[model samples]
Target: MSTQYEALKNADLYSTAFRVEPPTELGERKMTPRRPGFFITRSLSGATDAERAALKTATASQAEAPAANQAPDGSAPAPAAEPASTSRLLVPAQWGLVPHWVKSASDGKLRATKLVHVKSDNVGTSTAFRDAWLNNQRCIVPMQAFITDDYRSGGKPKPTRIARVDGLPMGVAGIWARWQDEDGSELLSYAIITINANAHGLMNRYQAPGSEKSMPAILNEGAYDAWLGSSAAKAKEFLRAYPAQKLLANPVEKGRKNPLGI
Candidate 1:
């Protein structure tokens, strides 16, 4: 291994830019409500059918006149019923996980954006991620690829993109949390789980010089259901580095197009 790679082998440098391309099958699955202004432009994972149906019904109801049960005075109608929860949908949430105890959304945003990845070794005990991990607030972060810094060239390191060789979306292991501000504004966010990659041949090739090498806990296709439904202990068993042989990496020139297409 090159000195640059060795120096950063224990580093914490990792990429947060990931692609979410929801397949057509996801549209048929039920989903939770989408929060306004919470969508990512690069994400292809659009709202689910359930969400669209609820929106259409709400619009139609609002267009109609007040119901006879209401008083003659012009007052607001009864609050709409809350949408029931469903497990079928794969919603696109923010990249970072924010703890529910955060004081303010603004503060939470700042902290969450910096916490895109949580160390698997400490996720179950860390103050910011422990509650979600313990409560089984797990989620699947589907991505086409993720960015990394490859220092294997020996001089200045270049940004590299890594993806599965099979061309399937990577289902990264993650934990999620829901935070709400005093004004009732809410934010749903998540963090990707990462494990030590210093010993992995493919993963040890990326990241800045002198930084710890780490890789996201990329889950196997057959393990998706188990990961989302299993306990923390069972989930931790899956937090291992993806096989080096199954990943492909390509370095991109600076100022050029992002290899992962961002």
Candidate 2:
């Protein structure tokens, strides 16, 4: 799995790419599974006028929300929650997803490391992701690029940057969770969804030799809203691999570790 990625740092790209207002505090350019990050989800003002009343009736609805002002650790705040009428909003979150059933923070951390990415076919069956998937806790993770180790050159693994050929931001499909402990403490986190790429022209070259190849389920520009609001039965429709011809991958410089090119 790809354990690190490049977050979107350009303010203007937010509006053009996702049609959401840009957050004042953009997160780290290079994000790891253990670092704090951000994601985009439907504005929690109830999803819609029709769903608002039903939202009140469902005790364990996917509308479960985190604190609007601060994350559980008391850092990485985004813009204030938009009015309940808005369609979508940006949110601050932990890069790794923490299921609500976790017994302790340490256990949650251990699980988080292994759950940085969930396979598209297993989201509904994996214990780590079933609840979130069934409840429709879907989200979009915005990134400039993702870093992976390429071994196709017949040598040691090489870190490569995979991004859109047009240099636009990517809205990768993801699932968010709100884990609340018995003491009332909460942790908001998310995990990226990956699809089988063993047969993909561009993605087939990533990962180690002989290992099953997979890539992030990057969504098309027009499907952002539909993906965030899709239900459990239809969510899989949005988890397809991006077109190979539209993505560009480049090897990182010999000593440059930062994807921001600084």
Every model's TM-score: 0.67, 0.82
Error of 2 at 240 (Å): 1.3
- Separately for all candidates shown, the number of backbone clashes (residues 3 or more apart, or on different chains) is 9, 1
Scored by TM-score, the top model is 2
**Candidate 2, residue 50: CA error in Å?**
23
Residue 152, candidate 2: Cα error in Å is 2.1
* Model 1 error, position 78 (Å): 52
Q: Candidate 2 residues 1-262, lDDT tens each? A: 6798999868766655665556667768888876898888764432445334333432232233222221111122223432323356667789999998999998999989888899999999999999989988998999999988888777788888898887878889999888778787778899999999998888898898888899999876556666777779998986776778788998888876574354
Model 1 scores worst on lDDT over the 10 consecutive residues at 3-12
Which stretches in model 2 have alpha-carbon errors above 4 Å? 44-86, 259-262
lDDT of candidate 1 at residue 20, scale 0 to 100: 21
lDDT score of residue 12 within candidate 1: 15
Which number leads on lDDT? 2
